[model samples]
Target: MHLFIRATDAGAPPYLYAGPMTYRGHEGERPMRILWDLAHPLPADVFHYAKVNTG
Candidate 1:
């Protein structure tokens, strides 16, 4: 399935296209974390921003 991602909603940032992804697996019950394998890699800037902001 296709994936879209944005860093925040403060200014209603437009979602960046993360390309298609494949279901990888998941864990946990309460939160139900899910994993996906991206079909294509994200750009350097987008990857860095997402990583830093998300963590």
Candidate 2:
């Protein structure tokens, strides 16, 4: 499935298209941490932004 990510909902920030991803695995029932192998690698800037903002 395709993955889309955005840092925030404010204004009209466009969602970064993460491309199609394949399900790798998952853990836990409550939290459900999942692993996906992305078809295309995310750009360094986008990856950094997502990590910083989300983390």
Candidate 3:
């Protein structure tokens, strides 16, 4: 399956879906459970993003 993610680190690449995950509370609140698929990075450069001069 294909996926996308807003990666913070440029070196770290995205990956495929693994399993479910849960977020624990800090002090005394109920834990939050979130189920989602992981993102996978593409091998090729799909879009050529560059700064353009519109002067």
Q: Which numbered prediction scores highest in TM-score against the true structure?
A: 1
Best by lDDT: 1
After superposing candidate 3, which stretches have Cα over 4 Å from the reference?
A: 1-29, 41-55
| Residue 55 lDDT, candidate 1, scale 0-100 | 100
Candidate 1 structure, TM-score to reference: 0.81
Model 3: per-residue lDDT, tens digit, 1-55? 3333333346755533333433433443366443433343333332121112112
Worst 10-residue stretch by lDDT in candidate 3? Answer: 46-55
Candidate 2 lDDT by residue in tens digits, 9-28: 57846787789999999999
Model 2 pairs whose backbones collide: none
Candidate 3: residue 5 Cα off by (Å): 10
Cα lDDT computed for each candidate against the true fold: 0.88, 0.86, 0.35
By summed lDDT, the worst window of 10 consecutive residues in model 2 runs over 7-16
User: What shift in Å separates residue 46 of candidate 3 from its native position after superposition?
Assistant: 22
Q: Each prediction's TM-score against the native? A: 0.81, 0.79, 0.18
Per-residue lDDT for 51 in model 3? 13
Candidate 1 ranges beyond 4 A from true positions = 7-13
Alpha carbon lDDT at 22, candidate 1? 98
